[model samples]
Target: MTEPASARRITGAGIVLVFVYGVMALAATGRSFVQIVREFDDAPLAYGLSAAAAVVYILATLALMFSRSRAWYRIAWIAVIFELVGVLVVGTLSIVLPELFQHPTVWSLYGSGYVWIPLVLPFCGIWWLRTHRPAAVPELAAAAR
Candidate 1:
């Protein structure tokens, strides 16, 4: 039997998210690597934070891309939440304590380098997941049957 439209829609949204996150992952990784290579000793704390954020973005992208289970969805949600918190905290700190961050991270300056998309993407992701709850899939399939 064919999959229901709702299932397809949800999966499609997930695919779109995968693409977006993939781009973010690349940006974060590249920027972090560049900073670390250029001057790791200058601001080790900020550089390390950037690297950690890159890792999280990469993992979240992969999870969303290959996830077939609800557990994976949950993991993605958690990762996205962490990403949001990291951006907010780091952004605020960068503003409030400019001296602390001699270097920038993906979350630095409220993701200003990325046009604040990083700050907003997680909220979008959470909303998409909530609206596309997997529970709707069984209902859709049953109706189709």
Candidate 2:
């Protein structure tokens, strides 16, 4: 017998993570949507990247919320890694090539406009996932013992 995967997905800490990711997804999606629709031509690169970040956030949130299988776990890792890469790349570019971004993306300067949460969240997520992985089945549990 085995503990179900879904049960492990919503531990106390997991709930907090889910809530934060949900907020980030909504905030990024809404901000980028408004900026892109209202003034895309003003900062195409910034708005486009912001929109892309929003999508990534949404996917990451979903993956974490429903991480009931190995596939979902892997997807969550991929999304978070992508997010980390995006923030680092964009943060560096914002500093090195300021002219390329007329305005700020969600990842601008390592999420300076968002108080650097974007930079910190992915690391937290990966840590949580690694520490709180689902338990193995009876056979594997015995094998380890």
lDDT of 2 by residue, 16-68 (tens): 88888888899999999999899999999999999999998999999998776
List runs of model 2 lying over 4 Å from the truth.
1-6, 135-145
Candidate 2 versus the native: TM-score?
0.86
RMSD of each: 4.4, 3.5
lDDT of 1 at 14: 71
lDDT of 1: 0.83
The numbered model that scores best in lDDT is: 2
For model 1, give the 10-residue run with minimal summed lDDT. 131-140
Query: What C-alpha lDDT values do all the predictions have?
Result: 0.83, 0.88
- Model 1, residue pairs in steric clash: none
lDDT of 2: 0.88
Query: Could you say which candidate leads in TM-score?
Result: 2
**Which regions in candidate 1 have their CA more than 4 angstroms from the true location?**
1-6, 9-13, 135-145
